[model samples]
Target: MIFEFLLLVAIILAIAAVEVKDMLYAVLILGGLDLVVAVLFYLMAAPDIAITQIVVTAVFGTFIYVVAVNRTGRKEVIE
Candidate 1:
């Protein structure tokens, strides 16, 4: 039950993150949603995939956000 709820929430958040116009908020939410999916994967006994997701979300996702922020300039705000 809890896993199902988390999965649902993760999916919803992922969608919301993608649809959001604000780039920073979208990137943050995308990272969070990826982490949530990793947790769900752990709960489902897919430790390998879960670990991969965790690492990717923690490392690559942050890298992407940093690159994006650098390219866009920190002062610019997306509506």
Candidate 2:
């Protein structure tokens, strides 16, 4: 039950992240989706993988996206 819910929520978040127009909102949503996946991994008894995903993708990946967005300005830069 819980696993199915988590999986569904993660899928929804992934879709939302992709559909959103703002890069910062999209990055935050992606980070949230990553956390949901990490929880799913933990529930599947893969603690190491979950931790790595949390640290590597959820944290660092989000940070990198935020930095990139900041450097380029929050809105899309069109020439």
Candidate 3:
């Protein structure tokens, strides 16, 4: 049940990342989604993958995205 709930949360986060207007918010949502996925991986008996996911995706990826957003601005410029 908990795993299923995490999956649902991940799905919701993904959708939110897509729907959100702010690039920063989307990056944060993706970080959350990655965390949830890491939990799911841990629950599935893949501790290594889970740790990698948290370290690589949740941490570094978010940092990179945040930096990019900061440089590029939060909102998309429609041409």
Candidate 4:
């Protein structure tokens, strides 16, 4: 049941990350998704992989995205 809940949350976060208009919000949502995936990995008995996922993806990935968005702007350019 917990696994299912995390999966659902991850799916929702993925969709929200894509749908959000602001780049910062999207990056935050993607970070949340990464965290959820890490938790799923932990539950699946892959602690090493889960730790790597949290450190590499959730932390570094989000930092890179935030830096890129900061260099650019938060608003999406639809033109």
Candidate 5:
């Protein structure tokens, strides 16, 4: 039950992330999604993979994305 809920929340966060116009907010949301995935991995008995995912996606991935967005200017292209 809890696992399903977490996944649902992650899915909702993913949608919210995509729907959000602000790049920074989207990046943050993705970080949350990555965190949920890490928890899921840990629950699945993959501690090593969970740790790797946390370091790679939850941490560095969001940082790199924010850096890139900051370098490029965070502007929503409304066409």
Candidate 6:
């Protein structure tokens, strides 16, 4: 039940992340959704993949987001 809930939440977050107009918000949501997926992987007993995903999504992904944000200011409103 909890696993299903987590998966549902992850899916919803992933969809929202993609649909969001704000790039920064979308990146943040993507990272969050990725973390959720990693947790789900862990719950499913895939520790190696979970750890890799967690590290890549939380660390590397955030770094990429920061670089992108720095390259392009976040003040631009997206419609």
Best by TM-score: 4
* TM-score (C-alpha) between model 2 and the true structure: 0.91
Candidates' C-alpha lDDT? 0.83, 0.93, 0.94, 0.95, 0.92, 0.88
Candidate 2 local lDDT, 1-79, one digit each (tens): 9999999999999899878878899999999999999999999999999999999999999999999998887765558
Model 5: how far residue 42 lies from native, Å:
0.8
Ranked candidates, highest lDDT first = 4, 3, 2, 5, 6, 1
Instruction: Please provide TM-scores, in order, for all candidate models, with all chains considered together.
Output: 0.78, 0.91, 0.93, 0.96, 0.94, 0.83
Rank by TM-score, highest first: 4, 5, 3, 2, 6, 1
Model 4: residues with Cα > 4 Å off, grouped in runs: none
Tens digit of lDDT per residue, candidate 6, span 1-79? Answer: 9999998999999899878877788888888988998999999999999999999888898889979987997655658
Q: Give lDDT tens digits, candidate 1, residues 37-68.
A: 88988998999999999998767987889798
Full-model lDDT, candidate 1: 0.83
Q: Which stretches of candidate 5 lie over 4 Å from their true place?
A: none
Against the true structure, candidate 1 reaches a TM-score of 0.78
Q: Which has the higher lDDT value, candidate number 5 or candidate number 6?
A: 5
* Model 6 spans with C-alpha error above 4 angstroms: 75-79
- 1 or 2, which is superior by lDDT? 2
User: Per-prediction count of colliding residue pairs?
Assistant: 0, 0, 0, 0, 0, 0
How high is the lDDT of residue 52 in model 4?
100
Specify the poorest-scoring 10-residue window by lDDT in model 5: 70-79
Q: Estimate the lDDT of model 3.
A: 0.94
lDDT of 3 by residue, 2-63 (tens): 99999999899999999999898899999999999999999999999999999999999999
lDDT of 6: 0.88
Error of 3 at 79 (Å): 4.1
The C-alpha stretches of model 3 lying farther than 4 A from their native spots are none
